[model samples]
Target: FIRLMAKPEKLGDLREPRAYLTTIANGLVSDHWRRQSVEQTYLDALTLYPTEHQPSEEQRALPIELLLQLNTLLQQMKPLIRSTFLLSQLDGLTYRQIADQLHVSERTVKSYMAQAMLHCLRLKNQTDN
Candidate 1:
């Protein structure tokens, strides 16, 4: 109704008010479409912005062969123990934090970490040949 009033297309004299309303509505629709197109163009130019810790396929396999060998060697341990080791040793999370995240006691977390380290030592001995 307001759009029709603002952009009335025709004068009176029994001159089809419906035509004027249709004209205003058409113009408003066109304007709305144009705004959407322009907004889309602007957004397209904007960057998604990179993340600090982006995970990718190549990242799954590092060039550190020794680390890979050690990881493969430690595969015999329980999943929880391996995860604890990675989080605490590689990711640098504290034993307390690992315990909180894993719902285990700090002492147990420390023990798992120690076991992980010992596994790595064993791997080193096995690979030293």
Candidate 2:
């Protein structure tokens, strides 16, 4: 691993440090990617599991697992875009309310909302299939 990371020039008779570091870095990246893949696979499996039923008192807009997934997806978005989308859609804010809060024009607010909706829909379609 270190050898790859170091990418050392061929040594006539001695090893170089760069090759070693490069090798190590390559291994780390591969391992990191593997771990991420495993995590995503697990999360996907969890999405298929049925949520527990709550009493009338505990029912909510979405099940906990679904909400967690949504939160994770939202994290991928730019913060301002996410905020605008959530405020307008989830929180039921009007376009004017969103514009006032962000101090942007109403047209800008509408544009942000459209972009966010498209991103969300694309993500949903991918996951659903």
Q: Candidate 1 — which residues are off by over 4 angstroms?
A: 1-64
What tens-digit string does per-residue lDDT give for candidate 2 at 32-120? 66556655665565657565633232443235446556766787788888899989878999999999999998999889888888988
Task: Assess every candidate by TM-score.
Answer: 0.47, 0.52
Which pairs, if any, clash in model 1? none
After TM-score superposition, the amount by which residue 116's alpha carbon in candidate 1 deviates from its true location, in angstroms, is: 0.6
lDDT of 2 at 75: 70
- lDDT of all predictions: 0.70, 0.73
Report the number of the highest-TM-score candidate. Answer: 2
lDDT of 2 at 92: 97
Write one digit per residue (lDDT tens) for candidate 1, span 1-129. Answer: 664456556233436778877887897887666556554544444335355444343653353334445545656678989999988878899999999999999999989988888887887787686
User: Which TM-score value belongs to model 2?
Assistant: 0.52
